[model samples]
Target: MSAPTATAPVGQTDTDASAPRRPRRKLLFIGIVVAVLLAGAASYVLVLGPDAAADEAVPVVEEGAVIEVGTLTTNLAGTPAQYARVGVALVLSADADQSEVTARFPLVKDAAIAEIGRHAAASLQGEEGLEPLRRGLTERIQAVYPDGEVVRIALTELLVQ
Candidate 1:
């Protein structure tokens, strides 16, 4: 009689079948990572878009205060035949109070009166002569406050003697 031969169990081999499944699991892990990155990027863009647009639409304003000016009077230097006496109502701007304008009133008044007396004709016959004088006086008032401007100059009373 021959000795009994040794045999292996069914469906059991020395090589592993789970080796192929490892590659498929790695591919699934990479896909999940890429999907998470894309979702994070999309969320950031949607959140900040409106705030960026609104910031551009707003405007900035300057800060300061406004002051009202009253009328000033001064004498014109010249003979009665050569010059006409003028009275003007002017509106000006200043950062200081009425007291400051009052202190500088004499200087501003004199400058305006002198300019008008020198440039204007003694007898203004028509609109041509009057228009030039009005513009000239307005410019003179502006000189007093270089930073400020004159809004209006009205010849309330004008007398030639």
Candidate 2:
């Protein structure tokens, strides 16, 4: 009655069987997670290379000549008369001679006008249309300026009515 004797509780054990193994299991799980993370990072580097985002940038051509096609007024391909007035500027190759480009303005303008006329009014509405239009314009302009190809065709102004 004065003091309780040293004895184990009814449902409790003196030593826990899983006490040491719990910490070890936690550590093993942590190690496995770290290993997986490291593997993922390694695979990403291997697949995409070190500078993944850097690889996606477009290259700028230095000393590029620009030729203005002026404002092109044309009717779109439809039953109703829908016209488009687009001001285009052609960025010629870096190797292009400014003098030659000036001389070949007629050819360049003609090609660009023809290219613009090829598209329907609805097809040139969104961002999706810009790429195809650019590609087509480049192809058209490059035909005449084969030596100094058109690197880029920029739409300085666009209007459809």
Candidate 3:
């Protein structure tokens, strides 16, 4: 029935308009703080140079000179029917005497095989046993080359069958 009232009925105000602006202000402040923190880090690195302690703590050592002593297959001490074949590799220093180490390869192989033959299957299964074996091999190899050419010895391939 009646003709419509053409005007707004009333007392509502635009209160929510400023509510959305408050959140945008908070976000802008947070972004500025983050940017400042990142800029500070960049400037620190650029002005003071790289952190020497971090650089010294973990100096990446390059594998310079390397030698692969051939694989050795020998029966273990106590465990019969179980044989171990270890492929050995040695990392040498840049100043290492390659000729001297090459000349003593036989002794190194013999020492490694004999040391490996002393341990049983159980003793050589995990790190506990592997550590001593590695130490033994290192000592034996280093004994042959007192110049300390051999930096590290790795059993690249180890299989017990």
Candidate 4:
């Protein structure tokens, strides 16, 4: 008869069985660590995002205001016939100081005169044309002074030959 096979100790079986589970335990530990890190990153972004944005924002100016200029005369249709005469009054706005309006007067004048000449001659065709010219002039004036608004463009006098 053969000798009885050697038997492992009873408690040693449990140790042998647990050996294969070690890799799974390590993976679970890594997953938990990753999850914790992600949570911490999310919390940090949520808490400090607005503060960081605020730091980059520009400051507000409270004392800013606007100024308007009255009527100015300029040659129409690039001619001095004295027949195609037009008058334009601009209502412009400025910051707290009126210098901004004064400084931009030349630009304003050129733009207004050119626009009026272009629209006025055609607009003299009929009463309906006059409304369109008024609207066009107002819009043109506003475009010239985008930062400073044009409240109105009063056609004090419009004559075209």
Candidate 5:
């Protein structure tokens, strides 16, 4: 005959099987808690983080300081005695010599006037005409100084009549 198998008594459970299940249940609970925490953290970052950051205005960074070139009234190229009144400023590069620029301010103004004098009165009347004028002024002012000394030319005011 075959040997009889071992069996637990009635109303009793196996200790080994039950012991392993307790640790598994605890681990499952801990894993669920960790998942919930991560979800909460992600939601907070996605929803509320940008609003807190939006309160401050971002500042614009310019390459260097601006030197006012004052205003120049010059005769336009067209006939009928047309004239243009232009106010401009020079933005110096970071490494430029301020003293030299200040000493030669008159030459900077002269360069701007010469550029403006080349354009016709009708050409400087509208916004479309202003861009070319600005580019021309920048190039003209750069010619007055060494390369890279003048970073940009800012035209503050322009009136052609």
Candidate 6:
């Protein structure tokens, strides 16, 4: 008979049989570790990276003070005798004096009415109309005050008929 061969224990495989499995398990473990590391690096570079600060640079601007100038009704410039009822408010610059603006309320109201009367009923139809109206009112009020106190004009209410 040939030389007797070596055999593993009844419940276990020989070392040579398990050697290949050890290397495969090691390779799988290494692959998982590499994948985890790559994912972490990608996340940090995309989300929490250096460019984040520049992307987050949103400036905060303070809104100036506002003064309400009550509503006024005036006849529009167009034919057929149209009238517009408008409510006005003034946004004052940061250094403007509240008491001064309050004292000159009548002049402000008059200028607002005059400006409204310059625009036709059709001109005051939509946002296209209202923006110019605001700018004109601001200019007139500025002319009366001449102090640059009024920074913007807001139309709180508007109705044409």
Q: Model 3, which residues run further than 4 Å from truth?
A: 1-63
- RMSD versus native structure for model 1: 17.8
TM-score for candidate 4, please give it.
Answer: 0.42
Per-residue lDDT tens digits of candidate 1, residues 1-161? 99996554578553544346778898999999999998877776687664766777865333233332344333334554555656665554433344554566666677766766665354354667677777877687667756554444567655554
Top candidate by TM-score:
2
Per-residue lDDT of model 6, residues 79-147, tens digit only: 747999999988888888899988999998888888999999999888998899988998898887786
Instruction: Give each model a TM-score.
Output: 0.43, 0.60, 0.58, 0.42, 0.59, 0.59
Q: Candidate 4: where are CA atoms >4 Å away?
A: 1-83, 93-97, 120-122, 125-127
Worst 10 residues of 5 by lDDT: 53-62
Ordered list by lDDT, greatest first = 6, 5, 3, 2, 4, 1
- The Cα error of candidate 6 at residue 79, in Å, is 2.9
The models' CA-based lDDT, in order, is 0.59, 0.80, 0.81, 0.63, 0.84, 0.86
Tens-digit per-residue lDDT, 21-121, candidate 4: 77899999999999999998888789877477677685543433444444545444445553445566655433323565567777867776676666435
Per-residue lDDT over 24-106 for candidate 5, one digit per residue giving the tens place of the 0 to 100 score: 89999999999999999889888778565564565333468888889899999979589988999889887788888888888
Clashing pairs in 6: none
Worst 10 residues of 3 by lDDT: 9-18
Q: State the lDDT of candidate 3 residue by residue for 8-82, as single tens digits.
A: 336634564334677789999999999999999889889777785587687454455789998999998885788
* Residue 57 in model 2: lDDT: 88
Colliding pairs, model 4 = 65-94, 65-95, 66-93, 66-94, 67-92, 67-93, 67-94, 68-92
Clashes of each: 0, 0, 0, 8, 0, 0
Model 3 clash pairs? none
Better of 1 and 5 by TM-score: 5
